[model samples]
Target: MTKNIEHQFSMLVREIRKEFVGNGPKEISTRFVGSWAVSEMKGNLTNIEKFMMGSKEGEKMVHEARTGLVKKIYSDLSVRRKFEDLAGAAILRIFSDIDIEADIAMTIFVFDRPLISKEK
Candidate 1:
């Protein structure tokens, strides 16, 4: 299972590098824990629309893209094959809200078992 997870993570890194960098350099890190996948990336997005990402509209665009990235990851074949449920996720904060150059982290719930709630 560890090997499989590593392989899946590698595939994800490949996708990220291909889609964002296009044979360029980008810092990326990923981890898999108990059906949860986390990815931290920096220098992923080059520019915002046409202007710099520090602009007001650029921040909005990044926020919107963060939402869309969830759907995009879930749609991936590797991600889809790992876990069956993607309804209620945990933390999925990709792209820095302040600057596009900042590190972005993406966390996926990817729960394979039933979620349990504690009753007080």
Candidate 2:
């Protein structure tokens, strides 16, 4: 049941990125950790972004822009509601970061309560 929920969460995040950012990661894997959902995403770079990797400034720009944009996107009320519904908790914060050279991104969704039971 947890795996199913995680998979669904991953897919929803991937789609959200694709819809708002114009490109989505090729793969996303999610895990629940107390009140946090940590997701590692791969293949997030577009062809233009790959080209930008050739320069230090370009790489930094991409990294900053992607991280900032994602955080803002998730802050939307409707978007936050989707995640809250899935995790069964209100989201307190969101953290996003990306490695331009590695084409990988990490997102951490912080919830008001644990998504999984402690008794388990």
RMSD in order of candidates: 7.2, 1.1
User: Can you give the TM-score per candidate against the true fold?
Assistant: 0.52, 0.95
TM-score of 1: 0.52
**Total clashing pairs for each candidate:** 0, 0
Candidate 1 per-residue lDDT, tens place, 1-43, comes to: 5555545554655574466435322655556554455555555
| Deviation from truth (RMSD, Å), model 1 | 7.2
Please name the candidate that would achieve the greatest TM-score relative to the true structure.
2
lDDT of 2 by residue, 1-120 (tens): 998999999998998999998988998999999999999999998898778878889888888888889989997999999989888999999988898777889999999998888674
Which candidate number would show the highest lDDT if scored against the true structure?
A: 2
lDDT (CA) per prediction: 0.49, 0.90
Candidate 1, pairs of clashing residues: none
